[model samples]
Target: MTISMDQQQTLGLSPNTLKGVHHIALNVKDMATSRHFYGAVLGLHELTGDEVPETLVTLVAQGKVANFRLPDGTILDLFGEPDLDAPHADPKQQFTRANHMAFDIAPELFDQAVAMLHQQQVPIDHGPVSRPTGRGIYFYDPDGFLLEIRCDP
Candidate 1:
């Protein structure tokens, strides 16, 4: 989506000023479970050592943040909750319940991805629904965070 000079000026922003998403940060209930889920289950490689130097020491006591590298080189930062005993906000009650992250997959691998999810017994929220542009499947992570895997038609 290119922005014209006039549009950029009107918006007080420059065209091409912003590149792309560096990473997405999410608060997870359990670090170990989330780490295993993303790294082992999803096949995302964990970025350890220097990759995650500035950890969330302040937010969580003795807690560290983990960054996983996606196939596209996008990072997914999972931060463990500061207090596990504290009550978590219900996702159903939150206005952002519909908010989710969608990962693009190769068209050929779309069905394979669905099959993997099924083999793992992960509940499918909906889809293999079709659209003009593509097909997608919605599912939840261990933390109940909604995620989608989509492939362009």
Candidate 2:
């Protein structure tokens, strides 16, 4: 993935803009469960994350591709691989939720998500920390994957 400086410039690339994320395809033990968490609870509609493709959608996104397009142009790509070993959910097993993939949210919603997750009996590790950039809260996903809801200053 290494690119020379001249090649990078020719691609209209800069360190920062290219630094932004495109999308993250997560490995899920079950797609249905993930859809319930990501789509139903989190409010991300499935652009396609289904086994059976709809007639019209296939007509639009092309008749062949099956990808879930989220509202923010971000695809909530889900993979159902029962054979994949789940990563260690314990923080001691890893550090910085960034290693897993932090799902940043609005600072205002951090408390709400925490309370909701708590009510649902989900595990939360850290506080609503305020960084020089913004605020964040850390928690674990269904598979014990660490995630963060953050807001930039």
Among these predictions, the greatest lDDT belongs to 1
Q: For candidate 1, what is the total of clashing residue pairs?
A: 0
Q: Can you give the TM-score per candidate against the true fold?
A: 0.45, 0.37
| Steric overlap count per candidate | 0, 1
* Winner by TM-score: 1
In the range 1-153, model 2's lDDT, one tens digit per residue, is 787979746544233322233334466565567667886787776665343334235432543222365676654455555565546766367532222345555555556656666665668778668766566666788877766655555
lDDT per residue as tens, model 1, 9-30: 6543234432444456677767
Question: lDDT score, residue 96, model 1?
Answer: 32
Against the correct fold, how does model 2 do in TM-score?
0.37
Angstrom error at residue 146, model 2: 18
Native RMSD of candidate 1 (Å)? 17.4
